[model samples]
Target: MHRHKILVVDDEHLIRWSLEQNLKKQGYDVLVCGSGEDALRLVQDEAPDLILLDIQLPGMNGIDVLERVRDVDAEIIVIMVTALGVLETAVRAMRLGAYDYINKPFNLDELAIVIKKALESHDLKREVDQLRSTQPKKFSIDSIVCASDSLSRVLDMVRKIAGSDAGTVLIQGESGTGKELIAKAIHYESARCDRPFVAINCAAVPETLLESELMGHEKGAFTDARTQKKGLFEIADGGTVFLDEIGDMPLSIQAKLLRVLEDRVFRRVGGTRDISVDVRIVSATNKDLLAAIDEKSFRGDLYYRLQVIPLLLPPLRERRDDILPLAKQFIADFNREFGKSVHEISARAEMRLLNYDWPGNVRELRNVVERAIILESDEVLQLEHLPREMLSVAGTSPASQGLNLVLPADGIDIEDVERELIQQALDATHGNQSQAARKLNLGVDAFRYRMKKFKLL
Candidate 1:
């Protein structure tokens, strides 16, 4: 890790030398300047982590240097040092973005405390900025890419219902199908956009800790509870809480969740007082809740409360039109991150992408694209960029004979061979039309027409 750099600016050489010596002893890299002009020059050449500036300076004043520093990097922490009678100037310095004001003839210990606080504040701001960069921006639903009638209809329902505040939403989809993304889009686009959005994975947490995680616990509630702590629900008051994989929640916790939903109130784990929260509930699950209810694995009442507005997301294979676009998006993303210039995919590789079954859905597609980008050497990705299974599927149709008959081989009619394979696959699957169509890598309607023409259906 690079050293934390500190810049000290004061016209008094003795003061600057003493400050530099102290900061260097504390393991920080220090830069000393006799005047504000020299300080500005150092800032422009190599930006420092923090600047300790004296208000009184020769030539350019400290305030002028601070103004230039702020223009260069608003996030840089600045501390203004002034004499005892210059409190009013210090106040003006704060309005101009000085982090804190320190009076002269001050204790070194006190000054050290202020510096620590300023550094901590700067570190926290950096962390927040990083988190914001990773998180999807608010109200931008375009990131949830899909190109199927089923998914488009689901998105339309989400948009329409997102405006309303009364109904609870239940998002159903297979794992890796981006359920959490949908939940975020709903919360960020709603009236409670400014409020907190707390998320918890029901399946990820242990059964023993689930209650305490959902509801607050009083001090000494358990052996580890040294002090009282608010749970996720209390922290998310007047906001939204996303319960991912809701089907995996224990039956006991499910009952508690149901009570919270029905009455909008919950008691802490070991506390008598009840806490009321005006929160919106958004739950998602990969399992069939109705089946779980019938099997007594889940509470029926809670299921009903969660399913007020149901949204089902289709798996990637079901939305074949989105494959190429999603792959291209991932490719561009990885190229910039990995410092590669891979620009295009070969036609053969593109065909293989469309043909293979994406069992892991969108997440799987992203991984494949990233892997291909890493392995690819040239500007275009060839068939070798894909996994062996995908390549094999592209090489031979399961419906075809055992003979190795490559396409465009020895005057063989490619169209005739394709037609025969489609018929065989349909016949082999015993007219289970969708499965046969999937096996042949052809759309259902096209497979149906071919089956009829070949008199195989």
Candidate 2:
């Protein structure tokens, strides 16, 4: 939908006119300038995506204009227009940052191809700039949303330590508790944010390849080591390297990692000299490292080295208060993704969400909301939009298997007791109208009438 702008800079009248006509037919906004001075002015004003610059200009040469253009916007794509005799000048222009060059008395087809490639490069550069601009916002402290005080305290700690010069950080949490997100936030918030953030899963890599992955290897280190390779630590020298699932890392690799932590130097698998790097290590794990050490699967010294600052993330079940807020955030996200009009979740649906224990934690909750958004057609999300597993009687314990409660000396009212039982059945069944009715041993229609009378519908 976006129309690209092209600037044609040439002293020859016929060439400029031909280029303008052909480019206009190709759906580009064409601007023509007779000399380098006019081209510089149009660049400052129109800011064209691509420039077709003639090598021989009257006032200032095209290469001089390009040098000035670089000072203004280095990313501007410039294609030098040269004659056959001036081919050497075109190569010199390329060295000064010209994107590509086309021969004068050029084929229309060849010129079109060069213009297309330049525009594609320009678009890719814009996309990269946009991504670079948004990276800071992605890892900012305000990006994460939570409602519980437990998570609040955790995020507060993340804020305090994110900017510190800590050597090693260990994050421990169940799967789907957002440990990787916290790790990224720490890196982006630190002084090394401008550098790279490299991550590797210690459990995902095989033991044979894991050592080579953490430490570079010489060309003849192994059968597959055909060339000298830089490991993650070397590649992320001035940045943060996230070692995910570190508890599962093999003992052989752990010894090598320990050396890097202690001496800040490591040798390639078969290399003679050591390579020293200044890197901040942030490792995460779902397993108990202390238990792994006790079992002799993990080294005790490596465990202590990695846990210089330990961060424990509580599972979603312990933070019930965050359920609705996280659900709402997911709803907004899916609305944009699915192009839906759904806005609010019904209060009864909220109660069902609160009642169910999130065994899979936040990841399960996100999937549930995504599924609900796909199935929903109404403006408000209702209980029926939820998955059958969430609404089934299997998700809740039956009344006969309920908790033991002691009654006071003044016994509860009989009608009040009946109302409380109905509420519990509804909660357990996740607000399933028919299932709750069946659990209370009543007809569906009768149950609805009773629910209306008690204002529980």
Candidate 3:
């Protein structure tokens, strides 16, 4: 839980103070200096994890300082702080080994996001460097565990696609099928892992701002356009831009996105200059784009363009062979996370997990295992540890155990039910906390926390 120390190098005292306060508020240790010379001394003295150096510094310009910093310790991450229309300097700073550059007068929220991403990238880089001689890749087809032939075939396709330089890939699947996971596997397994891998959910943003989000906008493009901003496409140049839920992208923006796919260039909103990018577009969606085209909501040409290499992730129900394996893997993961000793699923629990339809797929399965691990203390996971819904959906229950807890059709808060269960266990055990905890198969600390939460102690 070491707090990341951020060094703020800005000639303007207000900017330095503002950055320091904001960074400190975000739980980051902050160091501030006005000159690049002083910044270098701080690098040697404080050994800040990251440096936000202003391009317009008073002396020993930010570019020079960045070069010297990299030369001294390439491990230290440096993000350039630029002003409006200083594209050339930012690009130069990038070439000189700056991790990223943020514009002045930036939104604190966006700046926080940038800093977080830079640090994450720095950590990944260090990990990769350390494991270069041993680990082949952090992301690979083998990372996904599945024995189902259906998934195996899909992975075979992914293997071929990852090695190829195909630009536009369309991934279609049902909800909870891990579309973004597939996207990342493609990106990190390819040559673009070192560069930025930016993703934006097309359905998450409003139609009014999707254009600016993709292509960026000039400082005064619109009423709220306070400064020039880089979009996902620009940021992901020479890397990958994952457009999640691309079927939800509006028609107007769809045409522009198609143009970028076709020509590899685009202009900023309200700007005449063409900004070229060499990013691979990997888009995914749960919607049927062809049907959207039939309804005239989506562009037919764009649909064809996006599906240059089509990938379909089959639903969990369809891949029944993968269900048990995936559940066991999730069980192992939750065991480590929850500090539980649960090692194996009971025969009845396995049957229930395999028989019940996973409407939420892998995500739902993970949640189910997490909840079970939280409530289970035994080395073996039993049927009663699962949610009651599983029995309801599977049309059976472990009746021999002689436990009766029926949830109403209208449903009740799970927390309320948990409190009632804890109280009942305590009552049955004559208020002996250890016996009550043992009766519920819950860890002593977990059982006590619930007791406190329900005001039972």
Candidate maximizing lDDT: 2
User: Predicted candidate 1: what Cα RMSD to the true structure?
Assistant: 9.7
Which consecutive 10 residues in model 3 have the weakest lDDT in total?
Answer: 393-402
Query: Which candidate ranks first by TM-score, i.e. highest?
Result: 2
Off by over 4 Å in 3: 1-138, 393-457
Worst 10 residues of 2 by lDDT: 401-410
- lDDT winner between 1 and 2, please give it: 2
Off by over 4 Å in 2: 4-124, 393-457
Over the stretch 299-406, how does candidate 1's per-residue lDDT look in tens digits? 888888899888898888777777877888888889999999988876556665766667888899899888888887788987667775555434355455343333
Cα lDDT over the full model 3 = 0.84
lDDT of each: 0.82, 0.86, 0.84
lDDT of 3 by residue, 36-74 (tens): 999999999999999998999886899999989988898
List CA RMSD, all candidates.
9.7, 7.8, 16.3
Higher-ranked by TM-score: 2 or 3: 2
Clashes, model 3: 0
